[model samples]
Structures are given as structure tokens and as C-alpha cells.
Target: MTDALAIATDLMPVLARHAAAADAGAAFPHDSVRALREAGLFGLLVPAEYGGMDGDLADLVDVAAVLAGGCLSTAMIWAMHCQQVDAVVRHAGERLRSDLLPRIAQEGYYLASVTTEPSKGGHLLTASSALLPEDDDLLVRRDAPIVTGGEHADGFLITMRAGPDAAPSDVSLVHLHRDQVEAQVVRDWNAMGMRGTRSVGMTLSGVAASHQVIGQPGGFRAIAVDSMIPAGHLAWSACWLGTARGALDAVVALIRSRHVPSSMSRDSELLRQRLARARIDIELAGGYLALVRDEVLRRRHSGQPLDDRSLQIRIDTVKVACSELTFSAVDRLVQLGGAMIGYQRDAAVPLERHFRDLRSASLNYSNDRLVGAIGTMTLLDGAGRLP
Candidate 1:
């Protein structure tokens, strides 16, 4: 077993115990974060030389799924952190790597991404921030629309235009420490789901050295297409599946304990059917997830990034299917569970919380937008024979 999976397994029970409280209070899962940091989970994607696990895609998926089964918020935080970690590991310069990766692995420094901007109008590709020449360093000024766990993150991968004269595509991903960037929480994170993510809007202004930006100018587009989409899509899908599995586990336990046959109202054979459907849905989703995961690992081992449109389409399909199927499983399990599933006070069931968290999957990037993108791709390319 990978260190990520092993450590995550040990953290699951503790995370589950506090998940309800985290949701109820709409607070960051600080305790869970602490445990993860201590376990070196924050550096799961960093290299072994940097004191990391040097874990593969399967390891990332396994750890994410396991954490999601216990707490969606914590799982998401981990996923976001891993995404940034991937960027740093794959694109960052030697100086930045030497300065940051080791500390991230040993000091428990959490990282978050700052890609979306208020002025960009929700298009993640466009950067609203301008990088200005200030002697040896650059001055970054812009407001990010949302920064999940921003308050707690030690730093952020701030996406911005390379310079004032740069084109829209000439963007850079800069890593700025908290002391360097001023994060003003512009909007409170009182959302209907994923409350523990603490995804608040923040106005940012910072200064970064030239080396802080990963890769060369205009390289962010490549990074987004190659690393960001695949990692984010796969990890998020696995986490969603984990949440569904947790709900299904609760439903199964409840049914096994009280599902008596005969004239009992809740003991219909249809109840078993509902449970079976939930299981099958999760299984089907898991199978697809595993297939795609294997492909991701294969390509990684081959030193080829998943940059092709066909692979991207496949990744999007996996994300959409896993999101829908997990939501379906949780919804079905809740319906079969009846009134007890609605109990707000019980942390053991977590049915209602699961429902709320699962709802965000479709809205994460809008399944509608992906469907449109896919349809346009199919129309243009003919969807003819993918390897």
C-alpha cells in the first residue's frame, strides 16, 4: 500500500468523528488537516528527495477516496493541495523546488490555487491580475473570486498575466507566501454545500520574485491542459465516489439491523432492490474510474501527459458520470433509509450532509458547460476512434 492510503486509512475514523461538527459549524477541518500534515500527506505528490511519498496517480486516487468517505471537506482540501503540488513538482524551477517542496513536506505548509479572478467573469483561463516589474521582483494585484481554504493556506499558486504587455495566453503561475500576499475575505463562505471548504472570495495583492512563477511565460495554458485538468478531474471524482460509498455503508448498516420481513412497512423487498441499485451504480462508476485511473498511471509512467483532446473528453466523461452516479447512490440510499436518514443530530448516518456535499459535484464546473464543450468537440472532430 502507498503511504497516502495507509495514512489516510488511519485518519478516516478521526475525520468521520468530527465531520459532522465541521459541517454544522461551517468550519475548516483543522484537526483533520493537522493529522494529514503530520502524516506528510501534503507532500504526497512531491518527490522523495523532498521527503514526499513520490506516490503515483493510483495513490492519489486511493487517498482522496478514502478521505472523502470520512469527510468531503477535508478530502477536497487535500485534492486542491495535490493539484498545486503537481504543478510545483512538474513545472517549478530547481530553486523554487528546493525552497518550497522540502518545507511543504516537513513543515506541514498547505497550499491553495488562486486561478479564478473576479474580473475574468468566471473563465479560469483568463487572468485578471497584472504582473508589474518592480526592480528584481514583480508586483501582483488582483482579486480572486474564490479561494478554498484561503485563510489557512500557507501560500497560493496565483495565476496572472506574465506582464502588462503580455497577451491573454501569456500567463504565469506564481507561488506567494501568506506574508507576501494580503488576503482580504471579500465574501463570506456560507454556501449550501462543501461548507467546510471555507471557499471565500478574497482580494489579493502580493509581490513575488521571478523564480516563484513556475515554468516560462505562456506555459500555464499547457500546464492547465496537461496536469491540472486530469488530476483535478480524477481526484475529485474519486472523492465523490467515496462520499457515496460512505452513505451506502450507513444505509446498509441501518437496513441490516432493522430490516425485518413480514408486515413491517420499511421491510419491503424493494428496499433491498434500492440498496442493490445503489451498489451497482457505485460499482459501475468505480469500474470506469479504475479504467481511467489505469490509463492516467500508464501515461504517467510513459512520461506522457494527458494533453490530447480525446483523453480530456474521456476525463470529462468520467467526471460527469462519477458525479451523477455518486449523487444517485446517495439519493437512493437516503430515500430507502427514510426518516432516520433525515436526523440532523446524528453524525453516524451523515446522509443529509452527504446529500448536500454531493450536490456541488454538478456545479463544480457546471456539467452543462462540459456537455457543451464535449458536443462541440465531437462535432468538430467526429469522435472517430480513440485509442
Candidate 2:
């Protein structure tokens, strides 16, 4: 925790410098991103073979929470970077894994989620992007609606669906170099919160694909079901927990700096109850994430299946629990913070961006839907007609 705190504290000045500009400019966190790269924070999950921390899930959560405490948008961007790294570790070629990962660890390359679409939306689904076969190469055309750090990422783990027209081409993950692929921003993203993340809509045209994939194309069912979504959900638990911590930090600072309003901050019992409840919820949320993450580590090392019915259940539970708790914490912090919280330009107000970035959780994993499926899978002894 102290190491995570120290790393976060060192990054605060840099993060603060860009937090407002990014929010106001509706631009990417380029400066803070560069600092993250220089700090070697991007390789937190890269395997030790590639000079990465090969950091456990716990470490990932800690770092995410720390940064989310400072700026949720930046933290999510970093989380996306870790997600990209995770894909390679789970599925990329030996050449890519060997050559690219080391540079990611040492030099710090940018990683982004080139997923998320409105029409054939497959934020985590492989059966959504449109793919066209052209001779030996496949032409992948993707229209992502909310791709985080789309313009800034050095590379993207883009998802494309095999359209009904193409040969039964396999659906899988492909790496897109910024220079090689045509990533044109289709829409401006001026979301009220998490604006700094630059989660813009993008269209990928005429992107050529190589043989290196994140599992066999048609075999993406395994990658998404068994690996990608679950890993992403677990990683987000850490990120939202960080947002909760950051929100709490914001309230504390506000209390210290502002004159407490007598209506709520001073002598109101209801307000006090709400604040107390928020505190309990955030702590409980954090604990849930920590416990599940520890379980993940234990299972990973021991080569044992999770005690939970499917690995997805625990992942879903943690995501739902933390996402709800963090959002509540942010709201309560603003309540306790009064009008000052609404002033986005102020450096001290943490609620604005935290509010926006935390929203990505449910959309990415959707624990509510996962729970029903988990119940059927566990009690019925088989995954049912739910998907």
C-alpha cells in the first residue's frame, strides 16, 4: 500500500497538471500518459520474461485505486493499457510477445481499448465487428463508439466481427499499429465527466490483419468467455475501488478547506448518516475487491479452479459491488462537498471525472446479467440459454 501510495504521490503533480486541461480541452492525457510511460507503470502486468512487473492482481488493483484517487480518467486509461498487455500475454505470437512486450515494460508503449460499438457493439464480444476477406489478408472495418484513448494509443487491440457476407472467417483479436491503421475519429466525446479520457467514437477502415491473433478466430468464444471479459472485470474492480478512495480523499480535502455548511456539514443528522453510510459502503466495496483478487492469485498459483461456480461469478460479483460502491462514494463526496464539487475547473474537485470514468464498469462486464447466468451455470449444472 505504501509503495502504491508513494508511486501515486509522485504522479500527483503530473496528473494534476493535465487533469484540468484534459477535462477542459476534451483532449487526451498526453502529459500524464508520458509520465506513466517514463515511470514504467504501463508494464505492471507484462510477464517477467518481458521485463514487466508480472505484478499480481492485487498490485494492479492497488495502482489503479491510487491513480483513480488522483484522476479516474487517467487511471482508466492506464487500466486500458494493462488490458492490452493482458491480451498479448494470453494470446499473441511468440514473436510479438518476445519483441513487443519488452519494449512495453522498458520504454512504455501506449495501449487502448479499441472496442465498444453502438450497432454491432462488442465491447467484449468477438461476434460483433465486421471483417472482410481479401486474398490472404483480412480487411477489418470497425466502428467503435466509445474507445478510450483512441487517438493517443500507440497500438490498439481492435475487435472485428466476421460479417455474414465473409467466408466463415475466424473472429479474434488483432493488433493495429497507429501508423499502419486508419483510425478516424467519427464523433466528438464531450461527456460531462471523465472527459479527460477522450473516449471518442472511431472508424477503422481498410486495416490489414496479420496471422498473430488472440486465439483462433472462431475460437474467440474461449478467449472472451474464459479469459478477456473475466480478466477485464477483475481489473476494473481495482480501478473503481481507486475511484472510491479518490472520492473520499476529495471530501476530506473539501472539509478542511471549506466552511462546513450548517445545513448538512455542520449539524444535520440525515447528512451525517448518509456520509457514514457512504464510508461503510466504500470500505466494504474495497474489501470485496481485495478478497476476490487474493482468491484469483491463490487460484492462479495453485492451478486450481475457483471455488465460485465459474470464474465469471466472482468477477461479476466484484465488478457490481465495487462499481456501485464507488459511484455512491463519488455522489456522497459531492454531497458532502457542496457546490464546490460541481466546479470542474477546480483542481481539488474529484467527483466530476470519477463520476464519468466509473460508468465504464457495468458496460464492460454487466454484473447484473452475469449473475443470472452464473446461477443457472452453478445450480442447473450447465450454462443455460442466457448469454
Candidate 2: clashing pairs of residues:
65-242, 129-161, 171-217
lDDT agreement with native, every candidate: 0.84, 0.70
**309 in model 2: Cα distance from truth in Å?**
3.2
What are the models' TM-scores? 0.94, 0.86
lDDT of 2 by residue, 103-204 (tens): 899989887776566764543554466666777767777777878888877777776665445332345677767776788999888886678888888887
* Candidate 1 residue runs with Cα over 4 Å from true position: 258-267, 342-348, 384-387
Worst 10 residues of 2 by lDDT: 162-171
The true-versus-predicted C-alpha distance at residue 129 of model 2, in Å, is 3.7
Candidate of highest lDDT? 1
lDDT of candidate 1 over 92-132, digit per residue (tens): 99999998899888987889988877666545566756799
